[model samples]
Target chain A: MLTKRIIPCLDIKNGRTVKGVNFLDLRDAGDPVELAAIYAAEGADELVFLDISATEEKRKTLAELVRKVAEKVDIPFTVGGGIAAVEDVEILLHNGADKVSVNSSAVKRPELIDELSGRFGSQCVVVAVDARQVDGQWRVHLVGGKVPTEIPLYEWVTEAERRGAGEILFTSMDHDGTKNGFANEALAHISGLVNIPVIASGGAGEMQHFADAFLKGKADAALAASVFHFKEMEINPLKAFLRAQDIAVRL
Target chain B: MKNIVIIDYGAGNIQSVKFAVERLGHQAVLTDDAATIKKADKVIFPGVGAAGSAMSKLRATGLDRLIPELEQPVLGICLGMQLMCRHSEEGNTSGLGIFDADVLRFPDSVKVPQIGWNRISGLKSDLFDGIRDGEFMYLVHSYYVPDCPEAVAYTSYGIAYASALKKDNFYGVQFHPEKSSTAGAAVLKNFLETVS
Candidate 1:
């Protein structure tokens, strides 16, 4: 059986991990490699590094960080944020990043998904959608859910799958940071609309929220940031909780 | 010291494979050169992406002709393993004809690309000596090699398929051992040290 994955997302800025990761055992919290190794050892099914840097050297710095993490960590990880072109994904994959996710750029050009999947195979391309409910309709957002677009969520994910995106990472903007739960209704709708795997993101406040995302939303995987970063929830215990709920998790 | 050569025909994640070898205290050179691959004591063929394009690159470099002829111990990963077979449904590509089996896409009953960790059972061969039955391996592919005569290990997604296969000196795994944590690393080390 293919087990459901638990992913810890790390935000990167200029080759370092941001966010208040309160792992007291870490000598350097900003060191993404060490943090990645820790997460891997602690049984994180995967990791995602969102490079939010806007420097001229952001590419080189992220590439360097990717190389370090790949050398030390033994689990698969994805790199995203500021990924607008094929060349950016090429350098990151060359440095050993397993997968690359495209968000605003895919909405901007749409052809970027086709070119990426054509050049590097769909398995390595992850299409991330940030959206919120707008008057009983889900509207897509860009740049960390700041810029809004007229495109509806269900139709967009259907198109992304057709465009050769192997997976869809759907983050509900309205439920984000509220720590209530995932947007299961919309997630279930997207899952039914696409044949590919769906990753439910945002609104993961409790462990049962993950279960609901899987059982209710029908998500293939679930991703969270602050809860895992702040030690409010640990991956192993979370997996244990999900297992007790009769969910298939990699123990 | 062993000369490890990774066939780099511009197909897949060659760097991670190289680093995985390095973690085992061995050095591997990524080369498309036939001479380098022929001279190596061991060869690791790692690939990801489309079968047609990967086969074309191998054909362009003449690695397609060179690979099946090499007598040294060779291991193929993911799409590399599928290409070692006779044919693949992906891109409607014909393979190198190393394995007698054919590659197939997973049924619509299951997700297209069955991602994440799945267990390998019915294990045999030196590649899984220390690894136990039901030990998980990382796999990410829509197409799979059905259980055949060469199958030494199996995994069940929508159906049981060959997760690993062996014939004479050649070995292939549908999973990415380099990315599969400790269990996967053990498989790689077993390949480099014992599977000869």
Candidate 2:
């Protein structure tokens, strides 16, 4: 049986892990490589490094950071946030990121998904959709959720799948940072609509939320940032909890 | 101090495999040079992409013929494993004929990619030495090779399929051991130490 994945997302800014993860055991929480090793040791199924850095120089630094993290950790990790082209994806994958996620750039030019999947294979392409409920309809948002589009969440994911996206990382903007829970209603709707695996992102507050994302939302994997970054929830115990709840997880 | 060659035919995500080999303290090289691959102590045939195109690239570089004839230990990952079979449903492509098996698509009842950690059991090869049954390994694929005489490990999704296959010096895994954490590293290490 395939196990539900528990992912810890590290927000990277200027080639360093943001949000100041202050674990006593960690020698340096700001180091992306160090934090990634800690997460991998703690039983994280996967790690996601969202390179929030915008400068070209810092992006190069992110590549170096990715190489370092890849050397230290054996688990699959994804790199997202500033990926805008096939070359960007190549740089990260060459530096040892298992997959690369594209968000705003993929929406700005949907054909980019086709070109990427054609060149790198769909398994390496992850189309990340940031959506929020607007006027009782889930609308896709762009530029970090400040801008809205006419494309509905379901329609966009369907198109992404059609364009050869291997997986869909769906983030609910309204629930992001709130830690209330995942947008299970929306997740179930999208998961039913697509054939590829859907990763539920944003709005993970407690361990049960992860279980809910799997059971109620039908998500293949659940990704969280703040709860893990602040050490509010550790992955090992969380997997144990999920196992007790009868959820199949990699322990 | 063994030389490990990761056969490269423009496939994506070979870097992780190379990194994993280096992490095991071996000198790993990514090359399409047939001579280099033949000279290596062990060869890691890593690939990601469509089977037809990947096969085309292999043929164009003359690697298709060289790969099967090599006497050294050869481990194929993902699509590389599928290409070792006799045929693949993907792209209606014929394979390298290293393994007497056929690759088929997972039924529509299950998700197309089966993308996540899955357990491998019924280990029958030294490739899984020191690894327990039901240990999770990262898998990402739509097509699979069914159980055959070469199957050394089995995993069930919609049906029981060969998660690891072995025949003499040729071995293949449907999962990405490079991305499977410690257990995955152990599998690679076993291949390096015991397969020879």
Candidate 3:
């Protein structure tokens, strides 16, 4: 049986983790590599390093961080944020990051999906879509879900799958950081529409929220940032809780 | 010291596999050079990506022909496992024919690419030495090889399929042992130390 995955998403800025990670036991919390190693040791199914670096030099620093993490951590990981072109993805993958996620750059150039998948194979290309409800309709948002676009969430995911996306990381801007829950209805809808795996991002508050994401949302994987970072929930116990819920989890 | 060479034909993430070996206190080199691969004591054929292009790359570099003929213990991972089979439903690819089986895609009833951790059981190979049945391993692929005589292990999503296969000098696993954490690291260690 394939078990549901629990991924810890770390927002990296200038090669250091940006979000407030409250691991009291750690010597240095800002070091993304150290945090990643801790997460891997804690049995995180996978890790996502979202590089929010703006300058090109910082991007190089991100790549170096990825190499270090890959060298130390045995588990798989994906790198994202500001991946606009093939070279950006190539450097990351070459540095030992397993997969590369693309968001606004993919929206800016839909063909970018086709090109990355064609070149690196869809398995290594993760298409991340940020969407929120706009006047009763889910509209794709840009600039980290601040700016909205006319593209429907369902329509874009279907197109992304067609464009050879191996997986879809859907973030509901409305549900994100709400501590309410995931966009289950939208996630189920996307799952029904596309053949690829769907990763539910945002709106993760508690263990039950994760269970809801898997049982109700039908998400292949669930990604959370602050909860895992701030030590609100531990991964192993969460997986144990999910397993007790009869949801298959890697224990 | 063993000369471990990871066959790098530019298809998948070979670096992780090399790092796994390094983690086990062994140094392995990544190369497409035929002479180097032939001289290695243990050969790792790891790939991740489409089978057709991977096979094409293997053929282009003449590694396809060189692989089956090598006398050393050869282990293939994921798409590398698929390419070792006779054929794949993906890309209508013809494989290296090392394993007397056919690669297949999972049914639509389940997810397309069976991502995340899955259990492998019915362990019958030294490749699975010290690894318990029902131990979880990370898997990511759309295509798989059905149960066959060469199957050393199996994983079930909707149906039981060959997750790991072995035939004499060649071994293949559908899961990414390098990324499977401790159990994965142990599996790789077994391959390096046990499968001779």
Candidate 4:
């Protein structure tokens, strides 16, 4: 059977990975190329580098960083953030990102999604939806969870699928930093409705949370931050915990 | 100087493969001309994308029939490897038949595209030299060949499938060694060194 993937997401700013990274190695841990090599050796299934900067200079730096990472690390990696157009997706992909994730851009101009998926097969396109429960309704968040799109979460997910997204990366902003666990109620509901793989994001405080996410929530993969970044948790042990729980993990 | 010819049928990812081989200090020429391919010491058939389209392009250039007759070491990557088989369920297309295997689609229980890095174990030939049994290599394929005598390595995705195969002068891998990092590059390096 196909093994469920374990991904570590690194937020990049000005060609450097932000948060949870120590500046000890090679001046700082923000160097995307060096950080990527380390993660690939640690047996990370996939890596996601989100360019947090919105400026053109920062985007150019991110593209250069992506090229460096692609040269050093030979694994599947995805790039996101500031990806608003098909040209943006093309540039990143050409630079070596195996897949490109679109969030706010897809919501603002859905035609971009259709155009990208058409140009580079659907498998190359990923739709990342950052959601938060607002007054009993799940609402989508844009601009790195700062701006509200007013679009319902489920409706947006369904629309993304119809628009040719290969996978959905759903992040719960409310449960993001808490680590209480994943938003199982929301994920389980989405998994039942979608045919493509659903990757559950946010609220991964412990290894067991991953188990629960796979078993109860039916997530194809889990993306974590603080736990893996701070060394509070390791991928092998987390995968061991999940495997013990009878979940399929690439060991 | 060992000259490695990489077929560029305009249907696959050629730059990465050429770069990977060149990084190891070997010459990898990406070309569609028969003269250059025939003059090379070894040949690499690298591809990505659909099977039918790849075969169509190969046939259009007459390289499909020309490839199997070369008495040199040939390594086929991903879709190129699948095209070497007798037939493929992908696009209901026929193949080079260099190896006696049929490529079948993964059952729905497993995902369509078996994407990501998976461990390849049970080494049986020189192709796996210096490579540990459980070491992981990168893979991204939807159709796989069932067990055959030529299989040098096996990987489990939706089911146990052939990860590496060697038949006489012909060798094939379902994974992309060019994009598989150091280990994958090592595998290609090994093939380059040993394919006399």
Candidate 5:
């Protein structure tokens, strides 16, 4: 049986981990490579590095950082934030990233997903959707959730799957920082509409939230940032909890 | 101290395999040059993407014929492993026939690509030397090789299947050791140190 994945997301800016990770034994808390190694050692199923400010110069730095992280960590890693073209995906994959996530750029040109999935396998492509509930309907948001689009979340996710997106990372804007819990209602709706694996993102407050995402939302994975960055929850104990709850998690 | 060569047939992430090899204190090189591959201490056939395109690339580079004739130990990863089989239902493609096994797509009941960590047991080869039964390893594939005589380890999804195979100098694993953390690194280390 395939186990549910626990992913730790690191925000990168100017080649340094922007979020202050609270691992005591880490020699350099700001170093993405060191933080990634720590997470791997803690049995994180995967690691995601998001380049918050992905300028051309910063992208080069991210690539170098990816190479450094891949050398030391044996688990799968994903790179995202400003991937706009197949060439960009190529560069990251060549630098040892197992998968690449695309957001605003993929929405700007939906064909970008087709081109990427065609060049690389669909498994290499991850389409991240940021959605917020507006007027009782889930609407897709762009540009870090400041702008909204007419396309409904359901319609956009269905089209993304049709376009060969191997997986969907759905983030609920309303619940993002609230940490109340995951938007299980919305996650279940999206999971029902698509066959690909769905990764529930945002609003992960406690370990039970992860379980709810898997049991109720039917999510294949759960991604969290601040909780892991601040050391509010460690991965091993979380996996143990999930295991005790009859949830299959990689320990 | 070994010169490990990762065969480059223009498919999938060879960089991770190269990095993993180097991380183990061995020099790793990626090349399609026949001479360079022949001279290496060990060879890794790493691949991703459709088997049809991968096999075509191998034939185009003439590595398909050379691979079977090589006497050194060779390890195939994921799609690389499938292409070494007798046949693949993917695109009805013919394989290198190194292992008398056939790759078939998973039934509609389960997820198409069984992605994430799954435990492998019934280990039989040095590839899993120190690895315990039910140790988690990362896997991502739409098709799988059913139980065969060459199987070295087994994993179950909808049915029991050959997760790893060994036939003399040729070895193949459906899982990605490069992405499987400590247990995966141990598998690769075993291949590098024990297979020869």
Candidate 6:
């Protein structure tokens, strides 16, 4: 009876926490390290720090930020965004990131997934797929969800799993900034296809949204950004609500 | 200063376990030396790799014999705990005969490497002090020990298996406390405080 997890995502740029609507118009949230410590203290199941900037300047800053946050919190944390090589994954892991998430890079060089999984074991690698509804069909998006890949959403997920990715992080680009609810239809479709843990991201407006994500969407975890960063919702109350709903959450 | 010795026989996640014990306000010494392991106030044997290989490493260092005879409390984690049983199906290897159970692999119909945070219910030991009946603990094991008299906690993945075991001075958990959050840290702390 493993309980479903609830994670708060923090986007990092220039060594600071930033969040935006659909990956644009970014605003400063807080210091990345301090914000991470606060979330961990507030009982966030896990944290994901995505480096929005891929430049050398931002990369070095993000790596140091990860190291600082790793020293502050005992819970597991993951680093993603602009990670293009096996050396990048190793550097992040060595810098105290429990897992390294690959999105665009995973789609570009699919072999990197196998090479990383073969070296570090599947448990440490997470394949992040950004999907959007195109012509009433879900298609995989690359380059931060701006470019569409040739692979279908479900097929790409299966391929990533076959390439030895431990978990699949599927983010719905169309529903990302809406905050109405999760793309349950897309999540349900993918969850049924993959045996590995599927984490649902994008379009979480209310506490009930998390419940729906787990119950109907069958997501192993639900990750949200603005709702948590802007104090629109607090974790303990949301967890309390989920618990009242009889959803298995770590209180 | 209570010295907690973690046997380091080239097993898995040794440093993390040592860091966890040290973070809990105790001295955790990672050692394979029988003399130091025998003299520690409490011992923790944590592993994450394959069972047969871990047992082979322990045998190479002769710690397989030195562990069970210790008068102090010893906590075995993951593969370290599984290797304390009569035999393990992993690599078809025999283990230290401390528990009267055999380690087994789940059926093909069920998922292999049952991972994530699962609730450990039916708890009946002091190791669960300050923890609720169905506390969720993180687990990542491919093989499990079948339910036995020593089972203090049971969790159901595909089938109900022994989540926690207690046999005299030897205690074993199929989960990693170092990896598990607060609930797990409490289990390790309770083991250290109560098992003397």
What lDDT score belongs to each candidate, Candidate 1 first? 0.91, 0.89, 0.89, 0.81, 0.89, 0.83
**How many pairs of residues in model 4 come into backbone collision?**
0
User: Model 5 TM-score?
Assistant: 0.96
Winner by DockQ between candidate 5 and candidate 4: 5
Q: Chain A only: give the TM-score of model 2.
A: 0.94
Model 2 lDDT per residue over A1-251, tens place: 99999989887877777642221122224678888888888999888888766786977898898888888898888889868788888888888888899999999999999998888888878899999988999999987777899899999999999999999999998888778999999999889999889999988989989999999999999999878877899999999999998999988
Report per-candidate DockQ.
0.85, 0.81, 0.82, 0.33, 0.73, 0.32
lDDT of 4 by residue, A1-251 (tens): 45788899887777776753221122224567777777777767788987777676976787788777776676678888878777787778767677889988888998877887776656778899998999989999987677877899999988888887878999998888787999999999888777678889989888889988888888888898767777888888788888787887766
* Lowest-sum lDDT 10-residue window in model 6 chain B: B107-116
Q: Which residue ranges in model 2 land beyond 4 Å of their true spot?
A: A19-29
Which 10 consecutive positions of candidate 6 chain A have the poorest summed lDDT?
A66-75
lDDT at B90, model 5:
85
How well is each residue in B113-180 modelled by candidate 4, as lDDT tens digits?
66666788888877778988877777777689998988999998757888888888889998888777
* DockQ for candidate 3, C-alpha atoms: 0.82
Candidate 5's DockQ: 0.73
Q: Write the per-residue lDDT of candidate 3 for residues B1-196, one digit (tens) a residue.
A: 9899999999778889998999999999999999999999999999988888888999998988999898999999999888999998888989999999998888989877778899999999998889989999999888888999999999998999999999999999999999999999999998887778
Q: Which pairs clash in the backbone of model 4?
A: none
Task: Name model 1 segments beyond 4 Å from true.
Answer: A20-29
Question: Could you give candidate 1's per-residue lDDT for residues B31-147 as a string of tens digits?
Answer: 898889999999999999999999998888898999999999999999989999999999899999999999998999999999899999999888899899999889999999998
Candidate 6 docking band: acceptable
Quote the chain B TM-score of every prediction.
0.99, 0.98, 0.98, 0.97, 0.98, 0.97
How large a fraction of the reference contact set does each model reproduce? 0.73, 0.83, 0.79, 0.20, 0.63, 0.19
Q: Which candidate number has the best DockQ?
A: 1
List TM-scores for all candidates, in order. Answer: 0.97, 0.96, 0.96, 0.85, 0.96, 0.87
Clashing pairs in 6: none
